[model samples]
Every structure is written in C-alpha cells, then in structure tokens.
Target: MNLFSDIRDLVIDTLAAMQGAGELPEDLDFANVTVEPPRDPAHGDMATNAAMVLAKPAAMKPRDIAQVLAARLADDARITSAEVAGPGFLNLRLDAGVWQAILRAVLAEGADFGRSDLGAGKRVNVEYVSANPTGPLHVGHTRGAVFGDALASLLDFAGYDVTREYYINDGGAQVDTLARSVFERYREACGLEPEIADGLYPGDYLVPVGAALKAKYGESLLDKGEEDWLEELRDFATDAMMELIRADLKALGVEMDVFYSEKSLYGTGRIEAAIESLRDKGLIYRGTLEPPKGKMPEDWEPREQTLFRSTEHGDDLDRPIMKSDGGWTYFAPDVAYHFDKISRGFDALIDVFGADHGGYVKRMKAAVSALSDGKVPLDIKLTQLVKLWKNGEPFKMSKRAGNFVTLRDVVDQVGADVTRFHMLTRKNDAPLDFDFDKVTEQSKDNPVFYVQYAHARVCSVLRKAAEAGIDAADATLGDADLARLGHEAEMTVIRKLAEWPRLVDTAGRANEPHRVAFYLYELASEFHSLWNRGNDEPGLRFLQEGDPATSQSKMALARSVAVVISAGLGILGVTPAEEMR
Candidate 1:
C-alpha cells in the first residue's frame, strides 16, 4: 500500500542486482539510499540519490553509476523512464498505470490504507493533560488534551500498543487549598456566613461541592476544625473535580485508559522504592549544591540533603529529592510515577505538558533515563497557549472558571470537531489563534471546513451517481477502468494520495501529529482545485454525461481522496463529516 516504500525497495533490489552482475562492488551500504518525490513535477515522478550517495564508496563516477542504474530501472515494468540529471541524480517517471493502481489500492484498503507497522507492537505510554484535579479543565489543558489524544491515535495507527493516560496532580498542597475552598462553600450550604478567604478557589463551579458535602455530613460536623475536615474534604473535592475533568474530556471525545494519582506514590513506598533503585545504581547521594539563578525555593538552600545526581544523567543540576524540612520535593513523586511506568514494561514514554512545563523537560527526561538505565526513551511535547478571538477581538474568560476559559467554554462555543482540528493546525510548540469568525466560515481559508468539504463533496458525488443509477458504490468503484483517469488534473490528486502512507510513517516516527492536519489540507487543496476545473472543463468532472465507465473511474479517484482524509482525520480524533451544514 505504500508506493514510496515499494519504489525504494525496488531501487535497492536493482542495486543488489547490479552488484551480482559485477557491475558494482558488493555491500556498498544502500541504507542511505532513498527514493522520494521530486521537488518539481516537471522533472519526474521520483528522484533518487542512489548514484550520488554511492559514488565515492563504490569507487565510481556519479554519472557513470547513474547511467547504468537508469538503464536497469527503465527495464522494470513499473518505471517508464529513468534519466540521469545534474551529476548522477536519477529522476524517474513511473508508468501512468501506477497512479491508478495506487488509487485502486486506496479503495481496497479504505480506512486501513495508510496504517504502518513501524512500532512493531511495542508498548508506548502517552501521558497528557495531567492538569491539577482542582477544577474543570481550562483552555491550556484543552490543547494538551487534543495534542496528546491525537498523538496516541497516531502512534496506534503506526502499530504501537498505546495506553492513553492522565496523571492526576492530587498529591500536593493544591488539594489542601481545594479542600479549604470547598469547606467555605460547605459552610455556605449550611446557611452560615461563609468566609471566602484569600488564596481559596472562588469559582461558582465549587458551589455544588459544598452542597454535596453538607448533604453527606449534615450539621454534626459543621464546626469541626481543619484537622478533622481537611483530609476528608480533600479526598471528596478531588473526586468531584475529577468528575468535572472527565466530563470536559468526554465532551471533546477523549477517553483515558488510566488516571494515576500522585498521592498513590506516597505511603505506598513507591517513591522510596524508586529512589532506592537509583541509590542502588550509585546515582543518589547527600550533597550540598548551588542555588539556581532564578528565585529559588525556600527548601533549595545550599545545604546537604538527599539529592539525585541528575546532572550525570543530563540534567542541568543535581536535584534534591528530600528537602531541608525532610519532606519530598515536587520532582520525587514524578520520578516515581515514571518509574512505575517503566516497571509496567513500556518500551517508550511520551509526556504532553503545557508550555509552562518546559523547564521540567530536562530533569524529567534525566529521571526516566536514570530510572530505566536509558533502556526506555522519554519524549516530552509542550503545547503552547491558545488565544481565542471572537468578533475580531480577544474572547473573554468564562466566569464559571474564575478568570480562565474552561475547556467546555471552547467546545460549547465552536463545537468539539472544530476545536480539535483548529488546535492541531499549528505545531505543538507554536502559539495558535482560534478565531470564531474564521473557523466557522464556509470559505476555503478554514482548514477544518476545507477538509470536511472534500469528504462531503465525495459523498455528494456518490449520491448523484446512485440517483443516476450508475452504481458507484465503494465496492464497485475499485473495479472501474481507472486508466481513463489520465488527465493532469485528476492525476495530480492521485499523486497526493500516494503520499499518505509515507506521511503517516514520517509523522508518527517524529511524534508530530500536526503533520496529519497539514497533509489533509494539502490533499484537500488539490482535490478542490480539480473540482473547480471540472466546472469549465467538463471532462475533469467526477460525473460524465452518459458515460458510466469513465464516470466511475473519476468517481473512484474522488472517493479514494475521502478514504485517505477519513483515515487522517481519524488519527487527529476528529470525525470526518459526511455532509457539511
């Protein structure tokens, strides 16, 4: 199904044959040889650097090797012409039937056409949107959620065993703050004047948590001290907020396989066990270190404390695990969590963090490397802020979220599909602007609409074909005489279609899911261009007047574009629209 890989394999096999015939030396390291689409279509279909790369190693001239390789490749039935250009670069033109064959392959495979076995079923753990479980998720969490979910799907489509995970930040002082905030609401529910103190959550979303606490505890424990109620309310409020978080994620069509609690690492000896693992590796020591350049933590004084030698493992400084107050630092539990993940036997780990967590990247990677002895690779992806605009001005925050816009706010305004697609239209580290006016427009400038319109257009074609009684179902389209689809406009789309499998492989390997969004945009652009041409040049249209065979051939090509777009959008976790509103 991967035409690029197939062509590359053919080029490699032809080189091996040249060696067998004594025309070239044996074992010239063809690993670096590549066959790729040429930059300019006028040059040829594919350009290979086989001759250019092997010239020095093969003790031959670049033009000499290219001349021989070109003749041998031209003999193959798949390649129509192989010409040497620019000092041994080989530009090849495949038989016109090859593009048709790739289109038929798309119809045959449908949703699974571009899937790859690149991961070889290796287990990969993707942790994202691990926002504090203190309130409903906000817009910052939304970008991480969409990016992480799409990345997990992309890795799965690339044949990895993926587990979507969310690490709940419920083990810190923030939970205590949540408890105190909910306690004020609880007092309000008890019909008493509640003291909504400073440094407490003031969102109206917590109003229900207070009512629920009163309903459960009654008036007996109403005036209890903080010691009696802090722990219990912390647990209760954490659960309530997690419920809200889950609803927000569900509204965006995200489902997590695990919700690991940071508190689970405490009192369970997991953190100690993880530190002991590092201790056994001679990576833990008691040492006094330099204070950081920025404003340092109170516990970060230059005193001897139990520290992990993270500098040896690639961190900027050795990090203290135990503070001067003898309590664990914030990083201890994170190290333990990744240790738990490594012990779970994942071959790789990926963490999706907010752009604010960029400072933790090196230390966290160092922790995982030390914990797993570098056997497990960790990649951290940071999603930057999303600036929302409405009516050509900056959007206001949600009062329900207390000065920040919640994930539900964005989803409720523009819908989940639009939110998801627009979030991915930019790279994870780049800032994104979600314009309400632009995203919902009917014009081609909007990527989500343009791509969805392509799929919907194909559906419209299928309907017209069915109404015409031409029987252009997906089942019959693959068997059409696709050779009739030889126009440059139609073949342009087929050339784009042939790049899907290669695109998925490259994007998955690089851990960049935004490439899928970009590819779909390009594919849609080509399809839309072809469709616009059909208005004036009747022969370029999907339907022909009274010619079912030619019409089916063209329809097959159009439907194949939808098939690829559906597969791409599926990886992005956005459902392809069958019909646009």
Candidate 2:
C-alpha cells in the first residue's frame, strides 16, 4: 500500500541484478540507498542517492555508476524514465498507471492503508501529567496531558504496545499543605470564619472537600493537634484531590492505564533497594560536593552527604540523594520510581514534563541509564507553556483573583475536541498560543475546522451521489473502475494519500505527535483544493449524470480521503465531523 516503499523495493531489485550480472561490484552495501519524493516536483516523481553513496565504496565515480543504474532502471515496466542528475542523483518518472494503481489501493485498503509495524510490538510506558495532588488540574498540566495522550495514541497506531500512565506526587510536603488547606475549608463548612492563611490554598474549589469531611467525620477532628490527625487527614485530602484530577483529565478525553504512587516506594523498601543497586555498581557514595556555581546561598557550608555518582553517567555533577538533614531529596524518589518501571519489563520509557523542568532532564536520564545498565532508553519531552488569549489580550491564570483557567474551564468554553486538536498544532518544545476567539471560527485558518470540513464535504458528496440513485457506500465505491480517476488534480490527491504510511513511520520514529496534526492539515488542504477545482470543472465532479462507472470511480477517491482523515483524527482523539455546523 506504500508507493514509496514499493518503488524503493524495485530500485533494490534492480541493484541486485546489476551486481549479479557483474555490471557493478559484488559486495556493495546498499543500506544507505533511499528512494523518496524529490524536494522539487519539477525534478522528477522520485529521486535516489544510491550511486552517490556507492561511489566511494565501489572505487568508481558517482556519475559513472549512476549512468549504468539509470539504464538498468529504465528497462523496468513501471519506470518511464530514469535520468542521472547533478553528479550522481537518479531522478525517476514512473508510468501514469502507477499513480492510478495507488488510487485503487486506497480504495482497497481504506483507513488501514497508512498503518505501520515500525514498533514491532515493543512494550512502551509513557508517563505524563503527573501533577502534584494538591488541587484540581490547572492550565499548566493541560498541555502535557494533551501531548502525552496523543503521543500514546500515535505510538499505538504505529504498532507499539503502549501503556498510558500517571504518577502521583503524594509522598511530598505538598500533600500536607493540601490537608491543612482542606481543614480550613472544613471549619468554614461548619459555619465558622475560615482562616485563609498566607501558605494555605486559597481557592474555593476545596470548599466541597471541607463539606465532605464534615459529613464523614462530624466535629471529631476539630480540636486535634497535628500529631493526632495529620497522617489520616493527609491521606484523605490527597485522595480527594486525585479524584478531582481524574475528573479533570476525563473532561479532556484522557484515560490512564496506571496511576503510580510515590508513597508506595516509601513503605516497600523500593527506594532503599534502588539506591543499593546503584551502590553495588559503585555509583553511590558519601561525598562532599562543591557549592552551586553562580551565587551561593546564605548557609553555603559544604557537608558530607549520600550522593549518586551521576557525573560518571553523564551529569554536570554528582547529585545528593539525601540532604545533610537526613531527608530524601525530590530526585531520590524519582530515581526509585523509574527503577520500579524498569523492573516491570518495559522495553522503553517516555516522560512528558513541563519546560520549567528542562534542567532536570540529564540527571533523570543518567539515573535511569545507570539503574538499567543502559538496557532501557528514556526519552523526556518538555512541553513549553501555553499562552491563553481572549479579545486580543493575554488571559493570565491567577488563582487569587479567581480568574485562573482550569482544564475544566477551557474544555467547557471551547470543547474537548477543539482543545485537544489546538494543543497539538505546534511542536511540544514550541510555545503555543490558544486564542479563544480564533479556535471556534469555522474559517479555513482554523485547522480543526479545515480538517473537519474536508470530512463533511465528503459526506455531502456521498449524500448527493446517493440522492441521484447511485450506490455510494464504501462497499460499492471500492469496486468502482478506479482507473477512470486519471485526471491530474485527482492524481495529485492520490499521491498525497500514498504518503500516509511513510508519514506514520516518520512521526513515530521522531517521537512527535504534532507531526500527525500537521500532516492531517496538509492532507485536508489537498482534499479541499480538489473540491474547489470541481466547482469550475463540471467533468471533475464526483457525480457523472450519464456514467455511473465514472461517478463511482471519482466517488471512490473522495471516500478514501474521508477514511484516512477519520483514521488520523482518531489518533488525535478527535472524532471526525460527519457534517460541518
């Protein structure tokens, strides 16, 4: 179904014949040989650097090898012309029937045309949106949630065994803050003036947690000191916050396969075991470290502490696992958490974090490397901040002003489908602007609308064909005489359809799901352009009044575009619109 792969196979077969006939060297390695669409369409349909890569290895000039390869390729029935160009590159023009066959292939395969087996069913764990369990998810977590969910879906489409995961930061001081914040709300729910302290959460979202606590415990915990109620209240409050987070994630159409807890690492001896494993490998030791470079804190006295030999594994400096105060640093539990993942037998691991965490990437990678002995690879993607816009002004997220935009706020305003699609329109490392006014517009400038419009247009075409008493379903269209779809405009779209399998492999290999959004935009553009062309040329229309065969052939192409559009949007967790509103 992949025309590029099909053409490359032909090129390899021709090269094999050249070696067998003694026309070329017997031991030439063709691993670097490639056949792809030329950068400029004027050059040719396809181009290859086979001769250029083989020249040095074969002890021959590039042009000399290209001249022989060109003649050999031209003899094939599928190749119309194979011309040597620019030192050693070979430009190829295939038979017109080749494009027609691609159109028929789309009709035959439908949405399954672009699927690839690049992952080879390797198990991959993608951990993302692990926001601290302190409150409902805010705007900062939305971008990572959308990006990671789409990435998991993309890898699944490329044939990877993907597990979507979330890690809860329950074993931190933040959960204690959450508990004290909720306690104040509980007093307020009992008709007392709640003290909104400087260090406590001041949002009204916790009012319900307060009310729920009163219903569960009455006034029994009212006068208790920290020792009497801290642990129980901390666990209770954290569970409530996680429930709110789960609801928030569901609003954006995200689901997690696992929700790992850092607290689990504490009681099970997992952290000690992980550090012991590193110690056995000579990667952990008690040492005194230099002060941080630039400016020193007021209490900048050096002290001996337990440090991981992260420098040997490729970090700026060996990092302390335990502070001089005999407490675990934040990075200590993270190392143990990933070790837990490694022990679970995952072939690969991916973490999606905010751009503010960019400085922590190297040490995290080094920790996983030393822990797993470099057997498992780790990829951390940092998603840049998202700036919200409304009425051409920046919409700041400030909790005190009660003006902060939560994930629920955005989803309720625009919608989950629009939110998810717009979030992925840019690269993960690039800052994205979410304009409330722009995303809902039905204009072509909005990619969500543009892509949805393409699908709706195909639906409109199918309805029109059906009203004219023609069978327009896929079962009927797929059996159409697709060779009749031979127009240049029609063939142009078919050529784009042929790039889907290649696109899937490229996007998956690069660990980018944004590329899928970009490709879908381009595919929709090609389909829309063809639809507009049909308006001026009556013969290019999908419905032929007198010839059902021609109409069916053209309808097959349009429906095939719908199939691919649906499949691509599905990977993005977007439901293709059957009709534009």
Candidate 3:
C-alpha cells in the first residue's frame, strides 16, 4: 500500500465532500493537487498543495481554503493532525498505526512491495550498448550497458513489457576494416609476416579469429584477392567479435533480448518502405539545405538531396535521408530501424546512446514521431563519459582494446556487482569518475558497500536471533507486535521504507535509474543511523535480554529494511550482499 497515495486519496475525498456541502465550488479541477513528503521532516510527515492550487479556481483565499481543509482532514482517524503552514500548504502528521501497517505490508509483499503498474504493461523497446562490432566493449559502452540494463530492469519492475536490445553496427566500413585486420592475422597464422596496417585494427584479440580462419581455409585463401575473401571474412570477423562482445557483456551480467543487425535494413526494401512512409506523409522531398552559417558562402555548394521534414517534428532543421549519389545516408538506416520497431507494435521506444551521439537525438525522435504518426513516443538518453581512476591516477588503456579500457578490464578488477552499482551512482547524462580505490574500500563513503552492509547487518541480526532460540523468520517477524515499534527513531526508518513504492514509480516514469541508487543510499543511511543509536540506548537494540516479545517486534523492523534493500538492488542488477567480506 502506498501511504502517500492513500493520503492523497483521503485529501481528494475530503475536497469532494467540501464541494458537496456547498463549502466550495462544485466544478473545480483537483488534478494539480499533490500530497508529498514535506521538504523538512520536522514540519510534518506529509504535505499537500490542495489549497494553494485550488485557491484562485475556487474564488477563495489559499489560507481560507487551507483552514477548512485542515479541519476536514483532522476528522480522519489516520490523520493525527493537519496544520496549515506557509500561507496555504497543509502539513499532515499520520497516526503511528499508519507506519505499522506499512511495515506489515512490507513483510506481506516482500520483494514485490514496491512493484508498480504505472506502465500498464505497455511494450517498451530499450536499445542500448549498440557498439560497433570492432572490438571488446570499452568503458564508455560499459556505462551505457549498466545504465541501460538497470533502466530495462526498472521498467520491467514498474510493469512495462521491456525488451532489452542491441543494434549491431556491422554494415558500415568499419567492419570491412575488421575483415582486413583479420586477414592480416590469418596471414600471421599461415606462417607469414602479418602487415599491421596503420588504419587496420592492431589489437591481438583478433589473433584467435585469424588462427580459426587459417584452420578452416588452410593455405587455400593465402593468395586470394580482397574481393574473394572480404565478404566471407567480414561475416566471420564480426561473428567472432560479437561472440567476444557477448562474453564481455556476460562478464558484466548483461544480456540483450534482441541483437538487431544494421545490415538487415539494407537490400531488403526496408529502407525504401520507411522512406516511402515518410514520403506519403509529405515529410520526404528533394531539397538542398542551407549552407552552415559559419561556412564561407563562396565555398559552399548547394546540391539537391533527398531530405526528411524533421523540422516539422521539433528538429532544428530538415535532415537529409539520402546523399546526392542516391545512396542512403547514415540517418536513413536508423530511420528504417526505428520503423521496424514501430511496425512491431511497441507502445514506446528508448535509445541509450553515448554522449557523442547527442546530435542525432532530435532527428531520430522526429523520425519515430513521423513514422509512428506521433502515436509511439521515443525517449533518447545519452550517457556521458566515464573516467577510470586507479592508484590515484588515470587508469591506463587495455592492450586488448588497444586504445581504451575494455569493459572486461573494469569488470575483472572489480566484480560485476560493484561495477554495476558504482556505474549508476551518477545520472546517465552526467560524467562519472570510477575510482577503484574509493569503490573497493569498505567504508560508509562507498555507497555500494554501505547499502550492501545494511542488508548484511540485517542478516547478522537474524542469525544472532536464531542462535538465541528466537524465531526471526519473515513469517514470524511479520506477525510480531509491530505496535511496539513506536519510537521516533524506529518511525524514521519506517518512513523511509514507506517511500520505496513511490520512489520506484518516480524512477520508472522519469527513466532515471540513478534515482534508485540515490534512494538506496538514503535508506541505508537511515537504517545505519538507527543501528548506531542502539549502542547508547539498549532499549533501541533489535534484540533485548529477557524480552522476546520486544526483540521480535524490533527485529521485524530491521527485516523490513533488508526487504526494501534487496528489492532496490535487484532493480539495479546488483546482488544483495548477504555477508560483506
């Protein structure tokens, strides 16, 4: 049960009563009314803007409306006191029984306590970590993978039918370069000096692909021309790289539901169909774009090209779909890819891209909007760069990847759980610094460890309770006398626990998984604070001497924190630490 939602409904019902009694206007919009936690906890448990938002509409002063509403709210048994503050806002203090019910709900629901149905099972396709099949995934792609995986999990938890997807960039010239790189390695395996061309991939990771090729073709492809072997090698090299990429993702515990090929859009009439759909909508036409503003007019040549009317759908300007030579531009295939997604009947689409792809956002959105006739909304999230630090210095690049740190490099040093949790410590669009020293250190400063430690502490309490011959299982704790948990310190932690369902819905709606990390940290802080307080006040301890009843009641509260933490960490793709060593 969402306590905030319950209180909001109470406020709404009270307002409707006011209208029925002729104390307020009959027809007033209460859609803007909100019940939320007060900015300052000292003020009250919750606050509402019902009076403030309804003042002008109701033809009444905010304070006048608030005064009457406070009296109406105080009539409810759940609302202990409703006080008017700050001209119009009504702050509410709920009865202690309300928090007790929330704790009972936590034990009853377990991990599903915070699950939301805000999405209503709408199909959402989340495309992320679409790195080119050239090498192992690097640090930038690592951030995208973690962010996207967590986001997909969050959406699923919020009741969205989420499909995690990765688009292969194998149709580009880069794959051709990869073919040549593998050819060199194949030559090296054939007992010849392999030429490490300047523009070709020089990483030794391709050496195994070359050895496999040699094993298959023997000396038959040794003297073959580029035309004869390029196509076969392109497929072979990409498939090999994809296998390695999958392994890299596996190391980080990421698995995509679909692996879309960029090549599938080509030579299959898909691109033509997508463009024709835009043409039928009068959004596609032959046109010459205005030269860029900073360019010299004399040097600018205006050539006719096929363009999409992207500006009509919120882009800054129309975008070209095809080049002057009649070949599809990079944007054309992406449009076709999204068109395929739309054809599949998804309710919404989300693309998680690197910061470098920021320029493509508006146009891609415009394409999906036009293609889906604005029925399906597309949200694009850009993950900024991740700077790796080790031993108080910038982490060096990987020899396997040649130029950047591979995802495996980071995952190998720190396990997948730590890597995933730490990566989400910042928003997708914010730059993140992954410090090995700080993240691995077992201290309160480390958020991952801190949160995990709270879960472990709960487990420790349960273990000690069991050793003392007290039944601390969920079934037993859930039935414990929760009314005994009336201390202010205990209520504080329960209040934080009560926010989980609201937090899940908010994070899911905003498509911001970082909020989950932030919430987990705050919840951990509240739990740890209560745990520390137990040292000075023996009465606050979860286990009491010669008082089994009180001990079970307090232990129930501690178990509720673990339940929420486990649920939160599950959304982040991090395993809850049963024991932190």
The count of residue-pair clashes in candidate 1 stands at 0
For model 3, how does the per-residue alpha-carbon lDDT over 398-494 read when each residue is reduced to its tens digit?
Answer: 8887788999999999999999999999999999999999999999999999999999999999999989999988888889898988888999999
* Highest-scoring model, lDDT: 3
Ranking by TM-score: 3, 1, 2
Per residue, candidate 2 scores C-alpha lDDT tens digits across 111-177 of 7777888899999999999999887787779999999999999999899999999999999988888
TM-score of each: 0.97, 0.96, 0.99
Task: Decide which is better by TM-score, 2 or 3.
Answer: 3
Model 1 misplaced stretches (Cα beyond 4 Å):
294-301
Selected candidate, larger lDDT, 1 vs 3: 3
Q: Can you write out model 1's per-residue Cα lDDT over 136-164, one digit (the tens) per residue? A: 99999999999999999999999999999
Ranking by lDDT: 3, 1, 2
lDDT of 2: 0.89
All models: lDDT? 0.94, 0.89, 0.94
Candidate 3 Cα misplacement greater than 4 A, ranges: none
- What 10-residue stretch in candidate 2 is worst by lDDT? 395-404
